[model samples]
Target: MSLGASDHRAIQPDNDDIESRIEAETLARMHKQLEDRRSFLQRTTSRRSSVCIYRVPPSLTEVSANTIAPEIVSIGPYHRDRDTVLKFENYKWSFLDYVLSFTRRNGNDLDKIIRSMSDLERSADATLISSADFVEMMILDSCFILGYMYLYTSQEDEPTFSIPIVTRDLLKLENQTPFFILEMMYDLMKTINGDSLELLALKFFNLKLPRRDEEILKSTYTPPYSDQSIQCVTLLQRSGIKIRRVKANSFREINFKKATLQIPSIAINDYTTTLFINCIALERCTPHIRTHFSAYIAFMSCLINSTRDVTLLGQDGIITSFSQDDQDILFLVGIQTVIVILKHIA
Candidate 1:
C-alpha cells in the first residue's frame, strides 16, 4: 500500500508551500511591528518636552519594587486604583472641600482653577487620563496636597491622615503631582507671599540642613570629573578624604575639592530614602535634564560599600539614619547595587 514516488513528490511541494506561507506571515508581522515602533519614536523624538515626572526604570525597580511605590496614598495615575491606597480617597475629598472653600474666600474661582489645570493637562503629555478625568484628578490631588502641606507646615491637627506616612507617600516616584501644578495652585490660593514650592517642600521634608555660614553655603562643589570614580564612602574616608555638608538648596549640588566632597545638607528621616531615590530616578529617566543627581548617587554608591561607610558618614555629620542601625542605613541606599547599576548605565 506504499505511495508511489510521484505521490510523495506532490506532497512535498504542498508541505513546502505551507512552510513558505508561514515564514512570510512571520516576516510581515515583524515588519509591521518595526514600522509601528519607528512611527512612535518619530513622534516622540521630534520635539523637546518637559518631563517633570517619570516612571522608575524597570531595571532599577526590579532591584527594589517597593522603593518607588506609594504605600499609604496614591497621588498620581499610576497607583490611583490600588485597594490599599484607595482608603486615602475619602481624606483627599475632604481636603478638596476645605481647599475649595478657602480658595473661594480668597477670591479664587474654582471653575477658573479647573480650567487652568485642564489647559495644562491638555498641553502636556503628563497623563493618559481623559480631559474630564484629568481635570477632576488635578483638582482633587492638588487640593489634597496643598491642604496637607498647609496643615503640615502650620502644625495644625490632622484628625484622619497620618502625616508621616503621607509624607513618605508624597516623596515616592510614582506618587508625584507635577511641581508646576503645585506652583500654579499655590499662586492662585496663597493668602500671603511665601517661599517657592521647592523650598516649602524641602522645608516640609526637613531637608534644609543648617550650614556653618554664608560663605560655605554659597561655595559650589566642583567634581574632579574623571573616568576614575571611587566605589564607597568608607573607602574615600579611609583614603583621607573628607565629606562635608554644604548648605545648598538642591541635592544635585555636589562638589569635590582638595580631597573634600561637599554635598548639599540633607537630613535622613523616614522619607529620606524615597525622596532621594525618586530624585535619582527622575534624573536618570529624563534625557534633556542634567544627570547631577544620578552622578551624585553613583558617586555615593561607589563610596558606600558597607555599614562601615555608613558609620563613617554618620560620624562626619554627612549622613544621618533614622533607624540608627548600620544595616538599616545600608539597606536604604543599596549602595553596592547602585554602584553596579551605574557602572552598567555609564
Candidate 2:
C-alpha cells in the first residue's frame, strides 16, 4: 500500500516479460495446429498411389470382428492364411481342379487362363504380392468361386457343399477376389449354356425380383436412372409410394420415381450384417469410385430405426429379416454404428 514509484517500475518489467512469453507460446501452438490441418487435408485429397485391400479397422472390428472378418472362407490377401480360414484350402484346391476341367472341356487352355491372370496381376494395383504369388492367388480364388457358383446354380444333384453361410462369406468385403479376376475366368469358360459372372453372382446370392413388384419394375425400367433420396421404406410406403423389386445385377441399382421405388431384391439373414458392412467398407476405401453401396446402406439404415420400422418394410415385402424380431434388424443395420465407423475411416 506504501509502495514507491521505483517499486512499481520494477514490477512492470516482470509483468511485461510474462505476457510476452505467454503470447509467444500461444502463437507457436496455433502455427503447429495449422500445419497439422494442412497435412491432413493434403493426405486426404491426394490420389492413392497403390490399390489397397485393407484390414478392417480395430475400432470397427472390436465390436464384432466376426461380423466383418471371414469365417468359413477367406479371399484376397487379408485373411488367406489364418488358421480358421485355412481349413478350407483343400476344398479350394478341389474346386480349382473342377474349374480347370470345366474350362478344358470348353476348349480353353488352362495354361492360357493362368497366363491371362498373370498379365492382369502386373496391371492391377490392388495388391502388393509378387507376380507369381498374385497369379497363383487369382487362379486359385477365382476358380474356387466360379466352381462353387456353377455347382450351386446347376440343376443336377451333386454332393451339396453349397450352404447359405458360404454365400455370406463370399460377399464379405475382405473376402472378395477382385471382380476383374472372376470376369476373366468367366470369359475363358463361357458357352451359350454358361452364364456371365454377373448373372452367376446374382444366382449364387439368390437375388430375385419379388413377383408382386415385377410388373412395375419392368414398366419403369428406363434411362435416366434416378436415385431415391428417401431414407426409409416406411416413409415411402406411407407417402403412397410402392417398393418394387427390380432385376438389377448389382445392389447399387436403386431408383425412385413418382410412386415407385425400384430396388434390387435382397435377402436379409444372419449374414446380412457382414455382407452390408463389407460392401460399405469397399466404398469407404475407394474414394474416386461411386459410393453406391454406402449410399444404399445409408438409405436402408435411415429406413430402419426400430422394430416398428422393420415391421413396416416387412409388410410391404421391401425387407425380409431372418428373424421376425425388429431388434435384429436394428442391430444388423447399425445405422449409428456405421456412421461412426465411416467418419472414423474418412
Candidate 3:
C-alpha cells in the first residue's frame, strides 16, 4: 500500500505548481492595490492644488462658524438648502425674472446662462458637496447679486433685506459664486449701462480699500520673535514704540521704522469684520493667494489684547471703531486662536 519514490516525486511537482500559481495571483492583487492608491493620491493632489473656493476649515469654524455663514441669503452650494436660507430662494427667482423681463429675452437667455455656468463646473471648489443642479444655483445666485448691486447703486426701492446685511451676506466665504459668473450674468442680462461689473461692485461696496496690481508675498517669511509672547499695543507703547496712523490706501501697507509702527487707519465695524473674516478665510483655503489678510489679522490680534489697546489705537486714529462697545472691538481683534492657526499656516 506504500507509495513508490516515482509516485512521491510526481506529487511534489504538482504541489510546487500550485504554490507558484498562488504566489503569482497574490502578487498581482498587491500590484493592483498599489496602482489604485497612487491614482487616488494623484486625483486628490490635483484637486487640492487648484481649488480656489473652499468650505471654511473646521479650525476656523471652531471660533465662530456663523462668522463665515450667510445670514440673509445663501449665494453658493454650501448653504443653499438650509431652512433659514430657503426663504430667500424666492427673491433670487424674482431677480432672475426681472433680468429676463428687462432684457426682452425669454427662455433662450436662461439657456445660454445655464450653458455658460456649466462650462465652469470644474472651477467650483472640489471640497464642496456636489449640488443636484450646480448650473441652476450659479445662475440664480449671480442674478441675485447683480440685481442687488443694481438696486443698491440706483437707490431705487429698498430691498427686502437691509442693504448692509445683504452686502455682508454676499461677501461671506461660503456664500460666493465665482466673480466670473457674476460678470457672465451681467453681460448676458445687459441690465446696466456704461459700467463694468467690477466698477459696479466697487460702487456697491463703497470700499476705500484700493487694489494692488501685484502682491509680493514671501510664503517662506517667518516673523522674528523678540520674546516668547508678542506684546500688546499698551505694552509696545511702554517699550518706547510709537504707533500712529499713516495715509496709506491699503491696510496691508503697515511699516515699522525707528520704533514707530505706522498702520493705515482702518474702520472696524460689523461689515468690516465680515470683510476681514471672509478675506482671511479665502487666503487660508487657497494657499496660492496672498496671506496678507491672515497676517494682518494675526498681527492685529496680537496688538489688541484688551480695551486699553483699542482705546490707544482709536486715539491715534489707527482704528476707527463704528461699534459703540469697545468690547466688541476687543472681540473682533483679540482672536488668539486665529494667531496660532496663522502661525502654523505660515
Candidate 4:
C-alpha cells in the first residue's frame, strides 16, 4: 500500500510513495512557518523597523556540507534562501587558499556525503536556489557568523548604532535559497540578539556596552499628543521620504493588512508617532529590493542618544538620549573628537 503524504516513517526499500509524501509535508510546514514569522514581524513594526540582518560568508564549502548532512536531514528542507550562495562562494575561496593544507584531509564516508548533496533546488518568495542536494547543506555553515553580526550592531552600541553585517549581504543572498531552508534560517536567527553583541564587543575592544539613561526609553510612556495635524514631519532633513499631513479623511495610502503586537504593560506618549505600512498581500521578494538597512539604524541611534543641537538636529558627539516610546528602545553611541570645545567657566 502507498503511504500517505504525512507519514513520518522513512520509506524502506521498495516503497515508491515514500519520497512524495516527505516532500509534500516538508513544503506544507515551510509555508506555514514563513507566514507566521512575516506576520509576527509586521505587527512589531512600531518597534524594530528593520528587524535583524544576516550574512552567509564566503568560506563555506561542499566537503563540510557532506559531513553535516545527517544533522541537516534531521529536519527535512527548511528555509535557507541566502546561505546557499554564501557557501558556494566561500567554498571556492577556501579551496583556493587551502589547497596545500587540505590534501591530507580525510575522505571517510565521502561517497554517501556526495550522494546526499547530488540533487537540489529551492524556491520561495524571497529566493530561488538550484543546486545539488549536497549544496543545500550550506544553511548550517554560518550560525556563528550571523550571530557575530547581530552582536556587532545591536542596541548596546548607542548613538553610534549600526546594522548587522549579514544585513549588508541579505540583499544579494535572498535570491538563491530554495523555500526549504527558511525554517532553519529562522532557527539560526534566534542566536543573534540578546547579549551576543555586547559581550563580544567588550571582549574585543576592552570596552563596554555603555548604558545610556535607560529611563529615556522608559519614560515615553504617557498618552500620545493629539496632533496629527502635520501629516508627515521628518526629523531627518536629508532623508528623502515624502511627508505630508494626515487630514481627517483625505488619505491616499497602500493597503497592508492591519496587525499589532502590543506590549500591554507599556503606554507611551509622543508628539511624533509615525507609521508607513502597506496593506497589500505581499507574495514575492524582488531580489535586492531593500538596498540599505543601516541608514535606519543610524537615524534611530541619533534620536535615542542625541539631543537636537538646532531644530533640524545634530550629528556631533555631544549626546543625550530619550526614547519616544518605551517599545522603541533606540540606544546610541557617539564620538566628538573633531569638534572644537568652547570654555565658559566662572
Candidate 5:
C-alpha cells in the first residue's frame, strides 16, 4: 500500500529525494517559506466562503454544572457571531459572511436563499450549490472525481449521495465539520454557473456537515473534487495497495493530455528572457495519449513554482493588493486541464 515517494513521482523511477544529498540551504528556505506563508494580503483580501471556524466556551452556566456534550468540539476556529460580521450600507454585506447583526431584517435575504431550495423536500433532488451562484468551473473536476467511482459502478446512474448541511438553523451551526470537504467545496463552488461534469460529480463524495465558522482553506491547488480520489489512493496504499513508481514514459499520453507542456530545457529560443517559447502543439489523437500528459504536468508545476510575478500593489502612497501572477496562472491551468479531462469523460 505504500505509495512512497517512488510511486507518486514520475521523472524519477525510484526514491528521488533519497537520490541526492539534501542541500541544506534550499531545504531551510522551504521551511522558512512555510512559516511566512500567512500574509497581510489575506487580511486585505475580502473573501466570503461557506467554510469558517469557531470555539465554544464551555457553557458558562457554572463550569461544572453538568456537561451535555462533555467534550470540546474540534469543529471550528466559529465564524457566525453577530459581532463578527460587519453590516454594510443598504444590505450589501459579504454574501458568504454569516456574521454581524442577527436581526431578521439583516439576514432575511440569506434565509430566503436557503429556504427556497429546501422546498425540494427530498435531499435527492436538492441543488446543493444555489442554482444562481456564479462560481469557477474547475471545481467540477473534483466533483467528477468524487462521483466517478459510483458512475463506474452499477448504481443505475442515479445520484445517491448526501452532503451535510446546517440549514437556516444557523443557531445549530456548530464549529466542526470534516474539513477538507468544505474547503474544496467552497473553492469549487466559488462560481456555480459552472456546468462542467467536474462540477456535477459533486453528487457523490459528499461530506458530513462541517462545524459552523470553520472556513475551508485550500492549501494545495488540486482540481476541484479531487480529494476523494487522492484520499482513496492514500488509504489504498495504507491498506496494502503497493503503488509502484514508473517513469514518465509509462504514462506518456495522459500526462500530455493534462499538461501545459514544455519542451525539455534545451536551447531553443535565444531571447533575453526565457519564456516557454518552444511550444509544440498537443492534440489528443487516441486514448493512449493521456498517459503521457503527466510529464507535462511536472514540467508545468516546476514552471509554476519557480516563476513568480510579484506585483506592486495599487498606487497607494505605498503599493497594495499585489498578487502573485503565479496564482492566477495556476487557476488558468486548472481550468484548461479540466476541459481536457472532461473531453474524454463527455
Candidate 6:
C-alpha cells in the first residue's frame, strides 16, 4: 500500500516469472496427455479390423471352463502354452511330415507355406508371439489340420487320435487357426487329396444336415425375437404348437408355419455343448457378427427345461442324442447355464 516505484518494478518481474513457469508446466502436461491419447488410439485401431481369434471371456470361463477349453489340441496362440496340449507337439510334427511327403515339391511346400503365413502375420494378429514363431505356428497348425482332414475324409485307416474328441477340440474358439490359412495349405497339397477344403471339413465333422433348396431359399439369418411370453416345451406342446424338423442350411433358419415350430434338426452329442458355447463366445467377442448362434441357443434353452421336453424333441427327430443317459442329453441341450452369459451378449 505504501510501495515505491522501485518496489513495484521488482514485484512485477517476480509475478511475470511465476506466470511464465505456470504456463510452461501446463503446456508440458497437455502435450504429454495428447501424445498418450494419440498412441492409444493408434494401437486400438490397428488390431480392431484384423483380430479374429480370441480367448473365451473370463465371464464365460467362470461359468464353465470345460465347455470352452480345448481338451486335446491347441491350434492357435491363445492356448498354445497348455501342458495338456503340448504333449501333442510330436503328433503335429508327424502330420507336418505327412503333409510334406504329399507336396512333391522337393521340400519347397513348407517354405512356401511359411512365407504365405508371414505375409498374413500383420492381419492375423501376431502379437502373441514373435513374427518367426507366429509364422511357424501357422504352418504347423495348418499342416496338422489338413493332414487330419485328409486321413479323415479318405478313410485311410482311423487316425491315431480319438476322432470325436480331437474334432471337438478343433472347434474350440481358442483352438483355431484362420480358415484361410488351412485353405492355402490345402491348395498346395490338393493334388493328393480329392476334395475341396469345404467338403472335407463338412465330411470330417459329419455336419450334413439334409436341406431342401427351396427351404434354404426361405432361410433367414435374423435372430428370433418375440414380444409374446416365452413358454417351455411342455407348455408349447400343450398349446398345440407342433415342433417339427425343418431341413435348412443354417441353424438360424428357425420358423413357424401352420402351427408348427419348424427348427433344423440338431445333434445333441458330447460335442454339441462345447460347439455352441464356443460359437456364442465368438459372437460375443466379435460384435460386428450377428448373435444368431447365441440367440438360437437362448431360444432352445427356453424351449428345453425337462426330460419330457427332451423326450418329445427326440421323438420328433428334432434332437438326436448320441448319449444313452437322459441326464447327459439334458446337460447337452439344457445348456441353460450358457443362457446366463448369453443374457449379457444376446
Put down candidate 5 lDDT per residue, 1-346, tens digits, no spaces.
6677756766564554554445666788888886666554464332212222222222211221111111221122233222322221112222233211221333444354344323322222213334322121112222322223233322544335311121111112232332343334333333323333333222222222111222222121223222222222234335554322222211121222222221222111111001111111121222233322333433333223222311111111111222434243343234234434545564
Writing each residue's lDDT as its tens digit, candidate 6 over 1-346 gives: 7999988887675777889999999999999999999999998876564456777877667545787777878888888888888888778999899988877564557677677777878666677789888888888898898888777667655556545778888888888887777877887775545667876776676532444434533436675444345687799989999988977677677888999899888887667777777877888777777777767776776787877777788888888864555565655344456556456565
TM agreement with the true structure for every prediction: 0.67, 0.61, 0.70, 0.24, 0.16, 0.71
lDDT of 2 by residue, 1-346 (tens): 7999998887776877889999999999999999999998887544232334555555556545677767778788877878888888778889888887768887887788888887877767644567787788888888888888887767555336766667778877677776767888877777446566776676555532233323322233223212444456666567788877777645556777877877665667666677666666666666676655556666677667667777866776766754755666775466446655656667
* Ranking of models by lDDT: 6, 3, 1, 2, 4, 5
Best lDDT among the predictions, by candidate number:
6
Number of clashing pairs per prediction, in order: 8, 1, 0, 36, 60, 0
Off by over 4 Å in 6: 1-51, 106-109, 115-125, 156-162, 190-199, 207-223, 245-253, 322-325, 329-346
**Candidate 2, lDDT over the whole model:** 0.68
lDDT score for residue 264 of model 2: 68
Evaluate all candidate structures by whole-model CA lDDT and list the values in order: 0.69, 0.68, 0.73, 0.28, 0.28, 0.75
- Candidate 4 lDDT tens digits, 207-277: 22122333212212222222122111133333443322222110121111222111111111120111100
Q: Is candidate 2 or candidate 6 better by TM-score?
A: 6
Model 6 lDDT, full chain set: 0.75
lDDT of 1 by residue, 150-205 (tens): 76666544446455777778877778777777778878776453766665565465
Which pairs clash inside model 3? Answer: none
List clashing residue pairs in candidate 1.
Answer: 221-255, 231-302, 231-303, 232-302, 232-303, 232-304, 233-303, 233-304
- Model 5 misplaced regions, further than 4 Å: 1-78, 82-84, 88-299, 305-346
Off by over 4 Å in 1: 1-52, 124-127, 155-162, 194-199, 206-225, 229-269, 312-318, 322-325, 331-336, 339-346
**Candidate 3, which segments miss by more than 4 Å at Cα?**
1-52, 101-108, 115-133, 154-162, 190-196, 208-230, 322-325, 332-336
Question: What TM-score does structure 6 among the candidates reach?
Answer: 0.71
In Å, residue 58's CA in model 2 sits off its true spot by: 5.6
How far residue 309's Cα lies from its native spot in candidate 3, in Å, is: 1.2
| Per-candidate RMSD, Å | 11.6, 12.9, 7.7, 21.3, 27.7, 7.6
